[model samples]
Target: MVSDFRRKKLLHMYKFLDKDGSGTIDKKDFQLAAESMTKQRGWKEGDALYKESLDMTDLVWNALQKAGDANNDGEVSADEWVTMWDTISKSAADREWLSQYCKFIFKMQDFNNDGFIDSDDYVAARSIAGTSKEDAVAAFQKLAQGKSKISLTDFQKLWDEYFLSEDPNAPGNFIAGKSSFD
Candidate 1:
């Protein structure tokens, strides 16, 4: 059974991906998020970075649809999202999807393409999801554990903890910022 903490985290992730404020997540949501992110980074439509961001978002959306859209309706509902996580949680072999997702997110959040995510990068990424600067800073501090930045390897561990840990005090609980699990 999924713990309440893990369930909350899963739903939070679903909400984050459903960028269009619709009840389900579709390719359009991914496109909107990609556009928003590129715009925030000042990447114009024809820019290589902008195109890369779009491609990354498309890849993410395709993976998510394959894994979570159980009904094959071209969208992932909240129930489908939770059920997918619940099943994945029980199967150790099913974690490859999560690792790929973590890589994509890490790439997006590493604004400088420097292989690390600093507090500024964290704040900027969270800002796209409407998280306040203060909350993002606090969450990053907790997740970083006093470190100045988080590398991809460390982020993968935190990503696992975020999706799997039932502990309320887990550092990964702050992955979406302070308010997410509060």
Candidate 2:
């Protein structure tokens, strides 16, 4: 069973994934996310980085469809997404996909490629996702825990907690910005 706290977090995640605001997640959302990221990074078509980004997004989309599209409908609804997370949360072994995605997002958020996610990186990355700068800053402060930056290892732990932790006060609760916790 998904707790209220976890359900809220999962819903927030679903909203983020539904890039077209279509109330469901499909391959198009992943493509939109990739395009947005590449545009934010100024990586034009034919650029190696742009191609690599698209490939990565494709991998994520394929994995998501396989794991979350329970009805084989090629799209995942909020209920399916929640059920998938609930199942994944119960099995440590099933969390590999989540871990991989967390790493991928960490890399994306580390816009400077400096091996760390500072306030600037967090704000910029969240902004691309349509989060307000103030909310992003607040989230960064909470996730960073007074540190100047967040390392990949720390980010992985936080990402895991964000999805699996039922504790409302967990810092990971803030990872998606204020709206997640609110």
Among the numbered candidates, top lDDT falls to: 2
lDDT of each: 0.85, 0.88
Candidate 2 local Cα displacement, residue 20, angstroms:
1.6
Candidate 1, poorest ten consecutive residues by summed lDDT = 173-182
* TM per candidate: 0.90, 0.94
TM-score of 2: 0.94
Error of 2 at 28 (Å): 0.9
Residue-level lDDT of model 1, residues 65-129, one tens digit each, is 88889999999998888888777777876677578768988988998889999999999899887
Which candidate number has the best TM-score? 2
Global local distance difference test of model 2: 0.88
